[model samples]
Target: MKIAFYGSSLVSSYWNGAATYYRGLLRDLAARGHDVTFYEPDAFDRQQHRDIEPPDWARSVVYPATEEGLARVLAEARHADAVVKASGVGVFDTELLEGVIRNGASHAIRIFWDVDAAATLDEMRGQPDHPLRATLKQLDLVFTYGGGDPVVEAYRGFGARRCVPIYNALDPATHHPVAPEPRFSADLSFLGNRLPDREARVEEFFLRPAASLPDRSFLIGGNGWQWKELPANVRHLGHVGTAEHNAFNCTPLAVLNVARDSMADIGFSPATRVFEAAGAAACLITDAWEGIELFLKPDEEVLVARDGQDVAEHLRALTPARANEIGEAALARVLAEHTYTLRGAQVDAILAEEVGQMRSVA
Candidate 1:
């Protein structure tokens, strides 16, 4: 199958958390014998801070952030078997969504891959005339990163023909245990962009915990955190790249996963960090969220914390041997059920079924 995907940057993790998710899924699709071309807007300063070159597995096209560029990409998309326009493309998203749905109406299978399902759904619920809501019925299929049942049902209510979650999964080849790096070595580490939705959670779950344990070292790796005042024990390493994730994960005695408010309320949405940290054999401590056990068992495979006190207590009680056991268990669980290979196969089956159903109707 020939697939065309337009989303946030694929080669840079700078301010774009979806980079890992896109790289993992699209690389697996290409590996499974599909011709996949990724179309990313050249805005967002992603190219300026690129962490990786385009991979050989799939074609990566960066288009200008202009009307002319959208025209060219829409033309290119029309020829593919399936054309997907993902949320958070950083520019002209509504225009891009409409263009893909309009141009791919007859030939290509049109898909809206919402990486931030909770936020998208929230917007749609609050605004009656959200552009995406106007075109919900036109999409052939919808895919989400997380938000299991509630998200699916919400999309259905908005007239999405079909909605499925292609949850975040680990790419073992990209994220695995590595020798610990002295630079990133810390008692606790967290890697996430400081966004409005997630900043408060980071404060509650990561910064507060670090403050309570002043003697312990805590490291943060991501962009947009320079202005915030942090605890003395917490060190900030702005903009950790994709290549550094494995080492970053391995260097920490334990890694923290703090979901944004929208994701936490919706439940069942495990961010990509959870899988990446687990894949690197990092002892995981995460904020309480619904459906986390569906990914990793709490207290056994992962440690769950409701507040700063919980995180501090967990950190204080963690022994080297116990941390290793938890990390190993989490790693085993992700490798078994949360690898990109399995996700690729699921995507293949879903598309095939959709195609078959289309044929039957014809």
Candidate 2:
């Protein structure tokens, strides 16, 4: 299959989960013999901030990140077997969105691959910008990264023919645990880019706990957090790249998983970090999320902590040996159910079924 992905910047994946998701998925696709071309705007200073490059597996094309960029994408998309318009490209205009909607109908099965379903829906509900409503009504398929149930329902209610959840999965080779390093090794660590909505949760779940457990070294990694207050025992390591993520996860006695607003609320919608932590065989201490038991068995595969005190207890009571046991169990569970291999297979099956139905109609 020849697939063309029109998405936000893939060059700099520093604070971009969507790009990371695309990279992992496309790499898997390319490995399976599919020719994949990822298109991104040249804006966002992607050339200067690039964290990843084409790795013999797939091709990458950088456009202007403007309406003009979409024209180039559409021209290239004319040749693709399928074209995906992922949400959060951050450079969309009505001309581009509708061009794919109305004009590029022949070879392009324009898909709405939403990386952040909840956030995107929030945008759609309030402002009605980007001419997305019109584009969505014409979308061949809509794919969501998170938003377990409510998101799918919303998409359909909003007039999509099909809505499928393509949940995040761990690329095992990149995220597994490693030998300890003094610099990154800590009692507990949390890594995520800070956003305003999540800042309060971070304060409650991470900072307070670190303050209480002064003896335990707590570490935080990510960008957009320059303003956040930190306790004395907590270490702030800015923007951890994909390569450093494993070292960051493995070096910790336990890694913490913090979900953004919607995933926490919607339940069962685990982020890629959840699987990354598990793949590292790191026992996880996660904030209370709706459907956590579906991924890691509470108190067995992972420990849940809501308030500051709960986090302290987990840190105090969970010995390194116990942590190792929990980590192993979590890894086992995820390896059996949530690797990218499984996700790719699921994607293939879904696309095949959808394509078959389309062919029948044609």
Candidate 3:
């Protein structure tokens, strides 16, 4: 099958959190003998700070961030078996949603891959006439980044024909245990962009813990954190590239996973960091969220924390032997169940089923 995927950025993880997910899924799709073409807007300064080169597995097309560019991409998409437009394209999202439905209605299997399902649903609820809500029924399938039951129910409530949750998974080839880097070595490390939705959680889960453990070293690797004042014990490394994620994770004694407000409320939505850290064999400590056990068992595969005190206690009690055991357990779990190869097979099944249903109707 020939597939055209429109996402925010595939070549850079600068401010885009979906880069790893896209790379893994698309690469696996190509490996499965499906032709895949990725269309990404050339805005967002991603090209300026590109961390990875375009892979040969799939065709990567960078288009102008303009109407003409959209028209060209839409034309190409109409010729494909399936065309997917993800949320957070960072440019003319509503226009892209409406245009894809309008232009590819007959030729292509339209899909809205919502990387941020909770946030998208929140917006749809607030704005009844949001483009996604208006075009819900037009899409052949809706795929999400791990929103469990509530997210699927919400999309179904919005009249979507079919909804599937494609949770984030690790790409063992990309993320694995690497030698620690002195620059990123710390007792605890977190890598996430400073977005409005995540700032408060980062403060409560990360900063507060850092403050409580003044003697312990905490490192942060992300962009947009320079404006905020960090504690003395917490070191900030701005804009760590995707290639450095393994080293960053392995350098930390334990890594933290703090979900955004909507993700926390919706449950089961594990961010890319959770999988990456685990893949790098780092002891994982995460805030409480529903459906977490679906991915990793708490206190066995990972440590669950409710507040700063909980995080601090875990950090304090962690021994080298115990931390190694937890890290190994988490890595084993992710490698077995949460890799892109498995996710690609799931996607292949879903798309094949959709095509079969279409043929039956025809």
Candidate 4:
């Protein structure tokens, strides 16, 4: 299969989370012998701030963000077996969708892969400014990064012919436990990009835990949180990337996960870090989110803590023997059910199903 992906950025993970998810999924697809041509805008300076590249497995087409460039690219869209458009790209998304929907109908399948489901829904509900609502009917298929329940209903409710959740997945080969390094050693670690909405959750679910465990060393590794004044007990390591992520996950006694407001409200949708941390065989303690148990069995594969006190309790409970067991179980569960390879297959199935339904109707 030949697939074309037009997303926020496939080349950079700098302030771009969707890129990380796409790289994992598409790279897996490429490994499966599918030809992938990832389209990225020349804007955002992604080439300079590249995180994960084409991986020598796929082709990358970086085009200008102007009208002329988009028009030229849309012309080539007809050659692809599947073409994907992701949310959060700072362009004229509605117009771009309209073009693909109308012109790319000859040979390509149009897919809208939404990384931000809640924010998209919220926008669609409010005003005409939401670019996707009108274009939803024209999209061949809809895939979400992580909304287990609400995502399906909401996308279909918005007139998506088909909707599927392509949740964040872990590749165990990339995220395995390693020898503890001094840089990553901490009693607990939380790694996430800083955002306004997520900050409060961090304070509630993360910082408070640090405050409670004065004796314990907590680490924070992510971009954008540096300006925010961290508590004395908490150590901020700024931004860490793919090479350093395993160290950050494995060295800590326990890793923390706090969902953004949208993800927390939507439920069941976990960030990429959850899978990464679990895959690293870290004793994982996530802030109570509705859908965690569906993936990681609370008290079994991992633990869930709501308040600072709960974090403290889990910190104490996770001894070497206990923590290792939890990490191993969580890793097993993620590899068994939550790899990007599985997600790619799921997407392929959905696309095939849609094609069959169309043929039957015709």
Clashes of each: 0, 1, 0, 0
- Of candidates 3 and 2, the better by lDDT: 3
Least accurate 10 contiguous residues by lDDT in model 2:
96-105
* C-alpha RMSD (angstroms) for model 1: 0.9
**247-288 per-residue lDDT for model 3 (tens digits):** 998877899999999999999899999999899989999999
lDDT to native, each model: 0.92, 0.79, 0.92, 0.81
- Where does model 2 exceed 4 Å of error? 93-96, 103-107, 128-130
**Any runs in candidate 4 off by more than 4 Å, and if so which?**
360-362
Question: What lDDT tens digits, residue by residue, belong to model 4 across residues 1-362?
Answer: 67877777777776777766887788888887788988777776556777665678778887799988888777766778787787877775765677667667565678888898887887788876566877888788888887886889988888888788889988766778888899888888999889887989889777887888788889998787889888898988876767778888888888999888988888888888899998898889888878888888999998988776798888876787888899989999998998888887877677777677767777
Q: What is the lDDT of residue 62 in candidate 3?
A: 90
lDDT of 2 by residue, 121-235 (tens): 8777887654677677788889889677788898997888889898888788767878877889889899998987678788888888898888889999888766677899988
| Cα error of candidate 1 at position 63, Å | 0.8
Error of 4 at 204 (Å): 1.0
User: Model 3: how far is 324 from its true place, Å?
Assistant: 0.8
Highest lDDT: give the candidate number. 1
Candidate 1 matches the true fold with a TM-score of 0.99
